[model samples]
Target: MIIESTWHKSSYSRAETNCLEAAYMTTGGAVVRDTQNRSLGYLEFSAMEWSAFLVEVKSCDL
Candidate 1:
């Protein structure tokens, strides 16, 4: 029941210590986490939720 996904870091993250990673789940959702503290786990978001979040981020609304 475990799903595996490839995590990717943002290209804008030039500093190793200050980076976030994201992975797309098999269920069509996504997960995001701090690259520096991966052992802490990640935040899961549904596909719609993830899209809304991306829109807000791009618009600087949050």
Candidate 2:
């Protein structure tokens, strides 16, 4: 199930549009959505998946 959360963007993101917003899930995961079209809904990731994603991102492997 998806949990409601406060959406936020990367600190490095400066553009007002086309950016992605993410929120923490109470169940140790995350939800992501587009900044431009919130009505499109969001994507959820498990904690393990989320951690792997962050590792890839930090290593510029994504």
Top-TM-score candidate index: 2
Tens-digit lDDT track of model 1 for 27-57: 7778988988889998999879988998998
Model 2 error, position 39 (Å): 0.7
Q: What lDDT tens digits, residue by residue, belong to model 2 across residues 13-36?
A: 568656888998888899988877
TM-scores of the models, in the order given = 0.76, 0.82
Over 4 Å off, model 1: 1-4
Question: Considering summed lDDT, which 10 consecutive residues are worst modelled in model 2?
Answer: 10-19
Question: What root-mean-square deviation over C-alphas does model 1 reach?
Answer: 2.1
* Clash count per candidate: 0, 0
Q: Model 1 misses residue 27 by how many Å?
A: 1.8
Cα-based lDDT at residue 42, candidate 1: 89
Question: Which residue pairs of candidate 2 clash?
Answer: none
Give candidate 2's error at residue 38 in angstroms: 0.3
